[model samples]
Target: MDYLRVAGGRVLRPDGRVERADVAVDRDEGTIRAVGAPDEVDDAVGEPPGEALDADGSLVIPGLVNAHTHVAMTLLRGYADDKPLDPWLREDIWPAEAELTPDDIEAGAELGVLEMIRSGTTAFADMYFAMDRVADVVDRAGLRARLGHGVVTVAKEDADARADVEESLAVARELDGAADGRIRTAFMPHSLTTVGEEYLREGVAGAREAGVPVHLHANETTDEVDPIVDERGERPIAYAESLDALGADDFFAHGVHVDDSEVDRLAEAGTAVVHCPASNMKLASGMAPVQRLREAGVTVALGTDGAASNNDLDVFDEMRDAAMLGKLAADDAAAVPASAVVEMATAGGADALGLPGGRIEAGAAADLAVVDLDAPHLTPVHDPVSHLAYAAHGSDVRHTVCDGEVLMRDREVLTLDAAAVRERAANAASDLVERVESA
Candidate 1:
């Protein structure tokens, strides 16, 4: 089998301390086989006979994982910056989205993937409409993703809502293992506000049958806070538990309104939560109980949410925001150590998504990111994890490889046509902007 060796970088292997090593990958099988000094590569495969990427003494980590996103919103970025979640969705985003065609969705998804690859994200969990197009774009970009067919019950309290859920469930089933097993599918009932108990139950049942994940937003705002409390006579987590939907594989995003009780449910149910710190702060959504969740043994990862809300799809920015906001929320400067946050952005994210990735180790898929440690922002690094979490920006990501395929190298993308993506994004945004402004 042809082998590729990456030499001269400091790699963070799963069970070892960060050390300089050469990593060899069996490209034909898409698995990493050898990771040691360059000399060991020759032993593993004669002459390491293939492409050799010189890491140049940079810091290499498992590719950054973005656990939750609505990628097609790239067309809606910066549309309604200062508005609350509900109003922003209704007044700006939803209306603009109403005008989107499949081509528009493809353009936006392509733009989002380009941004993600450039920023070092190897895999992400995405929930949006027109998901076939999302799948197509993500597949073409050579990125790993768990796609969620985001379905909202047409009428919150009607039986029709259950039917809508079933429709989405069917779609998820059809696409669950599509895209060469690199893309997975999930059930996504938009939110408690949009889909009622029946649809939620249907989604839970659907997920149980497919053995896949369920991605959804929960307790993101106080607008949802009181309604869930009044209707269910309990918090969102309690209501979710009543429906048997919370679990490790069922990743819930934006737990901003969840209280101690909900945190307890998450812990007991082994549910994972994705903290979209930048989106929460930008939308003025209350900070999530991240410290409480962590202490309660809940898996917490970081996410950029979407370009529309965060106005940027940068996971490096997400990591920094998560760390700062995590400390601020707990009223302790050390609430989340930089090292821990880096883990949350990397390994923790992979765990939340149930993906076999997020570390440089033998038997692991060759998914990784390389950073130019020689850069100005990374100079004289006191702690590699700290520098990665706090100082690095997405622009500093030098390379991104996913599933043994190089999506980007030296800040140049290899998978998707970035220039075409940019052009289509511009045209799509112009159309959406005109629709929203006129509305």
Candidate 2:
């Protein structure tokens, strides 16, 4: 059989158990063929494998998923800081975004993809404009993604607003099955406050017809929620339900300010929420009731939001932040435990995005990350799961694999030229800042 074997590592099982195991992947099908002891994997495969990844001294976990992000915003990392969400968008982010060209999007996307690959993130959901360029990067970089064009119709001519909605639906329709089924698509309205109800209703209908899920920002801040409550006499989740925007397949970003009713509604609707702890804290957005959401059966995933707000695309840091913030928000040290955060980063993220590859069992998608435990920060090896939540950094990733393809091996990315991507993104960011300043 032609397969790729990841041998000699402690595999994190689906039941939160860690055991010494070897994983065999069907390279042709991009799925796991077996996950067990070396002899067991050899028995299942019935022959020697075609390739192998050295996993000694490493912990093999399902590839980390960044459930929500504006990946092309990597060019804006550290560009604007110390501001609330509304002002940050209006004063700095929006103006700079208006100046972005497709080339700039591609450059920034390449940089973000490189960072994700290096940091062991194999899949993500990206909401941004010029997403075709981002999809192109994902295609070449051997990563999985749910791609969408973010639509905002807050201040536009009716015709222009309608056109933006149409573009989002069109992009979703055209890109759903791209990248050999590694890429999915979503209908994305930027946010409740940033989009008109008419456009949202129309776009969501189109997306339902296209059989794609919807993604949006909701209840990110009290400022965002108060308007909906005051105008519609309902919370943002209820408002979203009114627009047919909440669905079992749909996922929302933030949900920071959601109350008990909103959380229950999300659970009842089977909608998922991606908690961007770093971005929320950076923008001073209210803390998400992650423990409550999870307790209410809402799928809680972790996201970096965007490099601009997160300052990096590192899911490891996000896991740590989510655990810390969840405890603080609930005032319970056991609110978000290491196991919970680990599951959120993996299975919850994949489930939220409606993508595959969150588990390391047979027949699952072959997406995995190998974390080296040889560092000083990871010493004593008391509990790998605990270390993953509190100590491990993205730099500790020794390898990243997606679709049975090794994107990074031994800290060197193979799918894209890391140095070249960095240089291009740096140049693009500089040019973009200059243009924004000149304009």
Candidate 3:
């Protein structure tokens, strides 16, 4: 009979409407039990049980979902910049990553999860090394994640490449449904160009056999798309289809260079694309055709990619960047309106990841973010949705909840010691840089 109540707030509904309500949670079940006015919610609960969160004078929206990110890459934040994907990865990122230790991975992941919780993100999809370490962070932080080990098989001996592919499949099998069912898993093939055709087909087949979805980088830049077209005589999505990788359950990250034909293929296959607007802009990776894809019935979600590229894991920033970039990419002010970006960050992400928390409704997972609108910047509220998409920053988040558990309240994180995690991560980042330089 454990219960938690979020009282006296305006709850944002799934369809962009808001209403003054109190949301009640069955903490034992970790699902929302009721969402209505105080009296109605109280009546539905019958008796007050455990605790209540005062959401007075705030907006209660579903917790943000970050669909794609390399969480442990937080150690590389600001480590490399102003280079395109290949050069950046080859000269700076890959070399540095080759020096990462399990301990370093843990520290960076803890910091990333801490930032995400602080920013009101309750769920994320992460691809990186030492995924077991990442899963540990997600468990301790009390957030949800879809995690996987990224497999890169280029220029490797057959034995080594097979081992890498097997490692990805093994990690996916081992980690799925971990962390009290808060963690799911996917098979990650890095990208089309990085992993060879045989490995991609074998890995994807193994994933399908295990009933797991696949995730990968696709059509991220002209450089990535050009080679595939030159060799295969088809677009990236079409080549992905040839590998048997594109499916309703699969999602690709950073479809920044997808053409109209590729967009059509994505829509028809029911695959999703995670648009990392900040990462794309920072790396000059070109803008994703988000408006066109959505118009063609493609489900587009939002992500920050990683702290290294995005410089932050704030879905608020992603929302603003998506709206602004979508318009510029389409040459129309009406393209990718504020409401659409908001949906992409929340419901769109949930839909893409095949998870259940993204709207304030009964029987949904009790994941939510509380935004304090009492500040001067948020003053004279005309449209909350507009402010959320265009004006809000992650700092405005006052509380974050996931699975009926309060992860943060009053801007204070409860699940982990933020100050301690930052210190550890800083130390780890310094050590990693030294090791990379020495190597």
Q: Which model, 1 or 2, shows the larger TM-score?
A: 2
Per-candidate local distance difference test? 0.84, 0.95, 0.94
How well is each residue in 39-103 modelled by candidate 3, as lDDT tens digits?
A: 89888999985988888988999999999999999999999998998899999999999999989
Highest lDDT: give the candidate number: 2
Clashes of each: 0, 0, 0
TM-score of 2: 0.99
- Candidate 2 versus truth, CA RMSD in Å, comes to 0.6
| Residue-level lDDT tens digits of model 2 in 80-129 | 99999999999999999999999999999999999999999999999999
RMSD of each: 1.7, 0.6, 0.7
Q: Candidates' TM-scores? A: 0.96, 0.99, 0.99
- lDDT pick, better of 1 and 2: 2
Which ten contiguous residues of candidate 1 have the minimum total lDDT? 154-163
- Pick out the ten consecutive residues of candidate 3 with the lowest summed lDDT: 48-57
TM-score of candidate 3 to 2 decimals: 0.99
Clashes of 3: 0
